[model samples]
Target: MAFTLLSRSPRLVICALLCIFLFSEVGVPRRASALGINYGQVGNNLPSPPHVVQLLTSLRIGKVRIYDVNPQVLSAFAGTGIELIVTVPDDLVPGMAASASQALQWVTAGVRPYFPATRVTGIAVGNEVFTGDDEQLKASLVPAMRNLHAALAQLGMDTYVRVSTANSLAVLATSYPPSQGVFTQDAAPYMAQLLRFLADTSTPFWINAYPYFAYKDDPTKVSLDYALSNPYHVGAVDPYTHLQYTSMLYAQVDAVTFAAARLGYGNVPVHVSETGWPSKGDANEAGATVENARQYNRNLLMRQVSGEGTPLRPKLRLEVYLFALFNEDMKPGPTSERNYGLYQPDMSMVYNVGLNQLSTTSAASLSLATSPATRTDVRKDFGSLCLVTSLAILLITQALLL
Candidate 1:
């Protein structure tokens, strides 16, 4: 009897495997690249980080970038398997550069405990330090980065977590031709040395480029379609590189590429640290309408999934992180600056950009809120609710079967 049962079990397992394969093949959309979202919480009313994890998982976004090493965010991401890139805020640079001990202490307290569970893949030493007003901060940028890298190396986490900084396009001198790009005279030496360090370490050079700003600055001169990634019209070409570019954003990227090439670090990889359009803007902030924001982000996401690269680097897949997950009302900027979020503070998408849905009306949207669960909060309210509902339905079906 035991041998006969074993003979039938193999057939049963085969049938189950076939069913699982067929179901999955028919169900999932064939997205090409891994999707990553930025989870910035500059607002006070955002949801808890754990709940944000639930929302991101439901949306199938596998990676996230946070603006700071908030212990709460780091702790919440533990065991979640979401790859995170955390920041070392600009203000921390002075202190970190002053003391290797401080850098070590900060890393030990802020990063060490969450290892293996949190999957912190990258550390941004500072955001747009080159663009900041303080000359000391600018000088401190690379040193702070070096100190942090040393600290990570001491902890044996250097290979797993890369160290780098994000630069604003203000670092560039001429971005118009996209091929004739160069750093401001004062910044050239510092930037070149930083680029060398980045290249040596195999860390990606991060830049924040926004064509929206270009268009807003000179709408009459900038083609709307060109800025929005609309291929309605034939675009310009770089005479030097002979690269035919379609969008201002790509041109901006290639300009940086050429600039790095000029500085002899052409091989260094560049990543878009931030880019997005705002749904609302001050009246003078041209091209900041809701429709334009939707189109810009939708098209950007489409391009990202298509695995498209700039004309200069045709084979490399572009790694991009959209800016501001929530429209942080408190952020000091033109109205548009505060409104670039993909979602609102209340956990709803500012607009849909082709997320999957079983029912036509369902929203598989992104949210910026953190999770409410404490470290000890084991019973996830959302997960438990879903489980209880499933169990109740199962009990009902079993009673009917009886």
Candidate 2:
């Protein structure tokens, strides 16, 4: 009877086999790395929010960190699955810290309306407050965080949105040897209080760790290759911990980790809020070329996708957000300041940092396929295939039994 059915339904059997093969062979949408880019809108000629959304989606970028809560940006990203990290500007910190009602009102106006639609995961209270010269603003950091967090809790958004501030690398007094890292005496008291709050609330300590600035300040001592994570350089070894560091970025991160540990907040996570290389600079700026920028960002992206962690925190993957999405023409600083953007204000890439080709069916995908990191989509696809295959086999067996 089974033979008779097979003879009559040969096309059906062939079609079923073809379907299984096609499903198995199709390239699944592999999960990209946990990398996020800073969507800095300091320029006057940046693309509109909708265009920006399309650009990010095209690049398969799932995470972004904006300097402020722009309603247009928030509305544009609604239902897009991209996780957004919004900020409370530094100027508003003092006022928000002084009044809980103000904090509540600010959240209601800026954040509460477009939440689930926008996917606002984290709220950065201020950018580099500890490094700034304003003493009053420095004092307002913790209070601002507390008031904002309280406001979030009152609105039932605390569980969904985390509160933290981004601090500069200048907050550290000594960052050599990684293990001996310590916060500067002036910033220590405030850092300790901030760390306690971060620990209690389980918020990450955001640091703008730029090795480029360190290299630029003292080019004679710092190896360019080390700063760029070049494989040719024999990187430094932490004398105390005997840990090897191939890149200055990881060393800086470990330093912050050690600094936090010293303050009895060992478990608090440290995230790189901003880090990038400049594509162009003045004659005095060493290693700020397009080649260096490409190498630095590409290598950084590869490491991020590989889920590589610092030597100090080998098990936990490092979270990093690259600085400046566009070259801000109005930014007042050294030439390097405006050149750190990955793209121009026109949305064209400054250089091919391997990110623009990430979603393409080119050699980049082949490179990604061989990467050490686990692709979430591949795992999910295989699981789905296995279920489908099992069902198909069961149906075939039942047909044969009949």
Candidate 3:
């Protein structure tokens, strides 16, 4: 007969799990975090920096990208070992390009004070300067990036922090098959300069790609399951490359990659600077329900932990930064803009994307399962621990049948 005592006590199951991990022959190795979040603060009702830090730590989020180099945010992240990617706002880019000294001044005053302690890894020179027909701003984008990178070099911090800019998917002229992806005629001239700069500096090319917008615009034509990357969904196939894309995010990423490849800078890595689904939207906005938001983010997190990559670049696992940690009340945009957040101002989850501490544990376990090196001793670990885990599950199975 099964041990009734073990079945009755949940604490015993917890102890059993601890022993399995602590005594397993195959050691759990530390892996670099592929998950990152955007910590935007365009709202007044958001929590304090320290409180925000606590919330992020509780979720085991180690990397964050903020819209600007906010001092309070930086100070709060110090010694927490959370890597930060700070931005130099769009309005300030022109001035940084016009005068190199201003670039140095900006870094010295804004970034230097919190360096090393805060773990600032990258400085985004500007966010989507190519959005409007702002010729002057687009022209200054590379110069501002150069000046900022030079400023880092001046302070002997060039080796640590990388400099780049975030762009919108509007830069693409053709992205239908992904292989046909190319820069818009108007954006090409500026993008060429930006691509060369990215290649020279060895920094990633950042782009904000939102599949929700596509689904919202044409819900009848677009598959909601495919957009949300739901399992068993029949995805798209690029006619030219014949690459099978099961997720919209991967297709969008490869579209950017192919666009860069057309320009002869295919070697440069493309990072998703921002992507998320809004839990709420205006009456006209389709597929913006809370359930869809929960499904989208939950699936995205699963993809990251599994170390899944785009079909085109399967070996290079995609590095993505999810947008807006909290729903910002003061954000000056449509209803969707204010709603693309995992949490509300009160630290309550808008929709749980598995943000609990257990998610981190799950990530580690997933990594361990995928590692070929760990499989060598799988028998040894599973043999010893399967009994305990099976008993724990048997209780639930028996209860269900009872």
Candidate 4:
């Protein structure tokens, strides 16, 4: 009823429309049919999950992965058809491994309530544990995965959803020429066990492969064109397999594929859990620029659209979740760490990678009452941006009426 009256008041209506525009986005579909994007919320400013879903739907982007099982996000995505891959924070790994009940409890609380509607396709056990210095954490990885899988099986959600953990490319000790790829001595035994679990579970081996790191560390040696997936660069020859690699991203992925094959689990699918270039960086952090970011993402999108696969596994179309959806301002480390988003917190594109714009759509209002706070991720965000704007519009309309 208020919407009716507000629509009749030109000035008040203008304010409402402007505020909504400030909080929402509708995008044109990139040619990519199955591109996945990572949604990180480490900033004090980000659109709420509902707004984000509307934005992604407009762009026709389908898959998404979040660092944690945020209840707000899980609830908002209900019936949205967005396949979400939620993570179990690293700190919870030991508890999950120590007790099967703990894992079950996690699933009961984090997953069960929203699953069928949320389309939670997978649960990432813990990210990059092998690359960390914690030996206990590395040892606990498999048990945690097993217990979680058992919990899923117990609940009959096993077949409905997959179980796996994302790993750092650093887990590889040797990754040159593709064929020489091997897991580090420290990570080898664990990787062996992990790969076996994946093979059994029929899940994927998730790797966060970033060729930008290799180039940033040694730009002169790593061709800029190759690193950015530019098609014109003379492809490098992986002498052992002789599979030519025109893109460093593909080479890194193939390296992981080879590493897994060496471990006798070649049938296990290798997916890129996280990969993207930063739009800005500090002076010491080389190769982090807006232009580079645009090129990297644009090229990657083209590959996804064309259904291109790595030379090692040419038929299996790569399923990649780009590193981030927004530039998280509060993330620690170098400036580059905070600048990986395709859009700013307010949802403005950092640089267009051919993601066109279309007509507007309504984003459902967010209900923060159910969004529980977590000790692990205590950072604040502007998820309330739309709500605040809506209130402003209401107040404006009320004043005009008075």
Candidate with top TM-score is: 3
Name the runs in model 3 displaced over 4 angstroms.
1-31, 357-402
For residues 60-93, write the lDDT of model 4, one tens digit per residue.
6668899899999999889877788999999999
Query: How many collisions per candidate?
Result: 8, 0, 0, 0
**Tens-digit lDDT string for candidate 3 (215-315):** 99999999998899886777999865667888888898888876775554555668898998999999999988899998988887888777676776665
lDDT of 4 at 370: 12
List pairs with backbone clashes in candidate 3. none
Model 1 vs. true fold: TM: 0.79
* Candidate 4 or 2, higher lDDT: 2
List the candidates' TM-scores in order.
0.79, 0.81, 0.82, 0.80
Q: Whole-model lDDT for model 2 versus the true structure?
A: 0.78
lDDT, candidate 4, at 1: 29
Give per-model CA RMSD: 19.3, 17.6, 17.0, 21.9
List the global CA lDDT of all models.
Answer: 0.72, 0.78, 0.77, 0.77
What is candidate 1's lDDT per residue for 130-208, written digit by digit as tens?
8778899888888888888999999998867788988999988878677666777766778887997886676779899
